[model samples]
Target chain A: MPRLTARERREGYQREYAFQQRHGKPFFPHVVFHDTIVSLIVVALIMGLSVLWYVQFGAIPTDPMAERTGGLLGPAYEAKADPGVLGYHPQPDWYFFFLFELLRIFKTPQLLIVGTIIIPTIWMVLLIGWPFIDRNPDRRLSRRPIALAIGVMVPIVLLTLTFYGSKVPAEGGAASTEPGAAAFAAGACSTCHVLANAGTAGNVGPVLDEAKPDYATALALITNGQGAMPSFKATYTEDEISCLAGYVATWSAAVGTTPGPGAATAKDYPASCEKAGGLFAGTVSSASGP
Target chain B: MSTLLPPPKEIAMMPVDWVEERSGAISFGKFMLFRNVPKDISWLQTLGSALITVFILQATTGIILAMYYQPTPDTAWMTIQWITNEATLGWLVRGMHKWGSSVMVVLLFLHMGRTFLFGAYKYPREMTWITGAIIFILVMGMSFTGYLLVFDERAYWATIVGVNINGTAPILGPALSYVLMVGPEIGTNTLSRFYSLHMLVLPSAIGGLIFLHMLLVVRLGVTSPPWSRMEPTEGDV
Candidate 1:
């Protein structure tokens, strides 16, 4: 169909105005009534959620670690912010799950901007500029196939991203009794690399489960650093590095399976743990009991 | 020719008439209340008003929260704990604010989707859509800034990542990151910065844009559902 001229569009709108003036209902009783019902529903829903969240929160736990373990709506609050500890996984609220998932897709340093800023910015620009871009005067859904398809596609894509984002494993590792495991969790390793044994799922560096680096490779990389991965040499002692490297080598390939090629065995962990001699030793002694 | 004492109804309406006479508010109120909307408008059209309602709830609850919320690192968490565990109905206020934010976002997207699918953004309503779009971005900004106000572990780390994401945006990335973080780290300044933005800056901007958006809506009038069979013909009247 030929595009409507500016004059035609204006006239069309004028006719619409006339028709509405003649046949439409008053905003006071008609539109206001619908709006009032919706507004009331929204208020009730918010209040209901608040009450549900409050009632579901069982008594606050005595254990600081378990404090505010919220109910269905989620906890009233989580553990206090401790910047010194970097082991915690960062998750945004549910609304941001789509962007959070975007970070996972564009995990590489080179493309991080694409996910973080570029894509979202472009989406915003497109959204704001849509009216100008789609100059077609047709408002009928059946008549505007492109608009209809786009309208459907955008929500589907966003919902898919949000679903995946919500499913992304928490990057924070579980508490481990093993000396090497403790060291790996305490150090900056959990912030970048995903190691299943440590329960970390950081996307900034290689997923150790997939990489399965041997002791020597893990040690060298940890000491020397690589692109986007910082060197730990300045921060960690040689022995501490060995303990971390051993931990990675032992667990990166997965548990209970023989590590591939030159990987450190579980037996090597005690020696590295002894040499590291701080948090590692503390964990070792605690694990051994008295 | 009127009697010394006005009729009882006029006496009762005296104050209202005086104010209306001075400000023309009564006429404007009448215009707003009595205006005609397209006959085919549906329940989906109420989403916009619903969004405004949620925002008003957020603002109210947020004010209640800010009364008790401490912005400093040392006391922020403690205050949050106090509000949730100690203050009467504090949990309810905070919970509503927390949950209300997500609701507002959901309603925002739904309203935007309705406008898009209905082709309500076309023609004279273009400005309305643009203003609404800006309001959408501002609402997201409000969300990002508000997340850190809780000052919990998750809030802190998420904000760290959030600021770092801002730092990834080419030439202005570092500057943006610096402004948000106020330094190399997320410290006292960062929390206060987020607090200011969340309550003061972003909310005001969104409120202003929403006013413009509503003005456009009232001016252009609501659209007829695109699928309605009652499409107005030019010569039908």
Candidate 2:
């Protein structure tokens, strides 16, 4: 596209303005009515889908009391101890999934600022500064290949990242072999304690590898709790607690090497954990012992 | 010039008539509403108007939501829950506001695209485009900050990530992050700061900027299609 000279651009704007003065429509009813109709349609669509889809609001807000009577959002949202996919790993809304995926892709701590901040900030600046930089007078998209390419690539990259991010687990580890993994997932320990075997990367508490508590210590902590880690005794059965403590003790020691226990045995605990139970139920052999 | 008002039958008449006579409100309204927009400006140009419409809808619904939403860390989520589940027609309003934001963002981008494609921001209208850019950033800011007001785990984590992203800027990154987050972390203070920005600062800035944008639109007149070289002759309609 040939750049317009200053005089040519000025004259062009003047001629356009003069033409508009002679033939332009009024803003009152014509433009106003057109905009209103379109906006009304949009509003109607929003309300219609809201009623039809009926989005599920998760558990109530996490509060101080939530610790005692389960979490504020309830146990439903808690990380599944059983584990096929750890669904309770907190993710941003869908719009932010692209960034979330970006964070995942740039996994190194050094690159955190680049993925999370620098790149996005640069994009925003470029977007706001686009008109200033691009002075081409051509009005057609075909003539502006560079601009068009950037526009198309942006959304495509975002969507691709978002799609990948949505399904990808936050942490890495082999599938849980021990039934204690089920108990761990069921008890919501995965939310706070990072355990590789269980595929949990919670940072709120000490990493299980670093603080490899024995069966007795795990059991004590699970029953009584300490610091920010609330006691799960009220929420779990003693059998379930034993399973979780044993699972953590074993897996915490064997951080990376082998997935301990070839498979789990099916022993019905009183508490039914849909998430954790689903994970262990399939993997269980008939060998039942801690 | 002859006076347009007809002789009134009664001296004390409608209140509107009294105001119109004293303040020339009718004339001002005419001047404001009857402004010309280029006939050649296609449906693409209407995106700006559509964006404004959705923005108004967002502001209205947001005002209603603010009536019930408590901006505390503890009660914020519970209040949102109440508003969503129990409040009369609250779900509809909240949904509209949410959807309206998406629509508004889409329209803003489309509108900016149209202006750029037509080269409307070339010379005299640069300020208009600049103000528009600022407004776009403000709108996105409002949306991001508003997302956290939901106080859900998703919202909380989103805010944490968002604030941290602010901290990723170069020299002023940490300070900017601190100011926005109201300390070094995302907490109740950060929530309140976001709430104030969403409800007050950004909206007010947008409102004033939009006024400037519209004034420029009215003053400079909407640009005709880039290809429209046909001029108005003496007998042209």
Clash totals for all candidate models: 1, 3
Candidate 1 Cα outliers beyond 4 Å, as residue runs: A62-66, A168-182, A185-192, A195-205, A208-290, B1-3, B229-237
Q: List, residue by residue over B138-171, the lDDT tens digit for candidate 1.
A: 8989999988888887887678767777777888
What are the RMSDs of all candidates, in order? 5.2, 8.9
TM-score for every candidate vs. truth? 0.84, 0.71
Q: After superposition, which runs of candidate 2 have C-alpha atoms over 4 Å from their true positions?
A: A1-3, A53-87, A165-290, B1-6, B9-24, B184-186, B231-235
* Best prediction by lDDT: 1
For each candidate, the alpha-carbon lDDT, in order, equals: 0.79, 0.66
Model 2 chain B weakest lDDT span, ten residues long: B1-10
Clashing pairs in 1: A70-A75
